[model samples]
Target: MKKYYWTFIFLYAAFSTNAQVKYADSLLTAGYTQVAAVEYERVLFETQDPEVRNEAILKKAFCYKLLGQYNEAYQNLLRANLFDENDSINDRLRYESVLTAFMASKYNDSYNQYVQFKYYSKDTALVDQAKVIAVLALNEQQKWGLASELVSELNESYSLKLDTAELFAVSKRPKIRNLKKQQLATTFFPGYVLVREGQVTSGLLSFTLKSGIVFSTFYHIIDKLYFTALLSGGMYNVFYAGSTEHAIESIKVNNQKKITRFNEKVSNSLFKALETSNFLLF
Candidate 1:
């Protein structure tokens, strides 16, 4: 009976219509991501097994990440981490969880998990990669003090051939160059409020900077620039309040695109006006 199921798994995994997922492990091994994504999604529907599901999810996310769909890839990477973080499956999920978090730019998450990963494997290469990522993130976030500390802990000799001192200097360039801008951005997008039926609320409505907020912010700014006022706000609210992490966590996309667009325009205009007149004390 066990053999029968194993045979089914093997045959299904072998002959899958998704040449990508069907042959992902091999393709990944050979660095053929261009052909791996198709099989990954196919594998999603091929089996209900969590392990298989996770493998497919990671591959799919990796495909998107490589394709520059950073947001989509991050979502899938997050899902895999959430699943694998459980004590029941942490051991099996550690490698992918750590890898996905790094790919998704969730440095703190990957770094925190690395301490756990340290006890589970002897793959020095993976360790080196993880440490670099953690340092890179710290560098990006302007914690250069912490980044330098972490860098010192790493064995500089293990760096890849391409990761020379000059490249390392260039790597820290993001921190040095964008340090001011990142700090200012946090304030630029301090958050938003919830307005309904002529009433404005804050706590249940404030939409702060987050993975989801970044998506909506970019969308709204684009929409406003295009003068599609109604459509822009609607889209913004849908994404902004669609989750608790957003605003009210109750905004609907289809029902409120116009309102969302208008609200954003008004808010943006007000921000500009305030700055022009120096009415807002920053």
Candidate 2:
């Protein structure tokens, strides 16, 4: 009777695991992402089958990904214990893991994982995708030379031939090289320089106030050549804020506010750029 009882307990446990998996699948299919993740976690805990547990873990990761909980998704993928080096599922999981890193705005981590994924998988398409992502990651950090080198490598890769439009689209987005030339223009028109460097507000206020006040004082001495050649630069040409140099200089005594605002805009832009297909090539 005791032997029979043990057998019944084993059978019930197996049934429970199977039921849990079924329920998780149903929930996932129904778009109940968070609850599905919980059910998958339960299957991972209850199942003795390694295959079942592995599948459960992957599904849980997918659930997290669907919910936009990228860090959690990445953690779940890390918990996957695949021993087979050539396992096809490993390739998929690795890609997904890299994707989660990208979604989380962990570009450095994503770039590293993408490189490893390319090395391990040797999938030409995946490799090309990884290269573009790496370029974007470096571009985000303002590493222009490295990003440019990667772009050149991408242009040579055959895999990118099929994705020509997207390749060109992403390639053109990095403006670091242009930024260097922009810095030099600061001497000609500091306002334009600031605006071009993502310090739009500061640039506008500073250039407008300074140029306007300068004009008021030297309006009689200032010639068309000086104004047309320097002050009439592209940056000043675009934004014309109504104020005086003295007013702007008074505020500029402490530049922390402008710096903070610029940083915030840059941070927002970084996340916005990541949401594009260019970042999530997978």
lDDT of each: 0.49, 0.59
What are the root-mean-square deviations of the candidates from the true structure over C-alphas? 20.3, 13.9
- What is the C-alpha local distance difference test score of candidate 1? 0.49
* Model 1 misplacement above 4 A: 1-20, 23-39, 81-105, 156-282
Worst 10 residues of 2 by lDDT: 1-10
| Candidate 2 residue runs with Cα over 4 Å from true position | 1-19, 48-50, 159-281
TM-score of each: 0.39, 0.51
Expressed as tens digits, the lDDT of each residue in 148-225 for candidate 1 is 555545534333122223323434333112323433432344342223312244422444324445565567677665
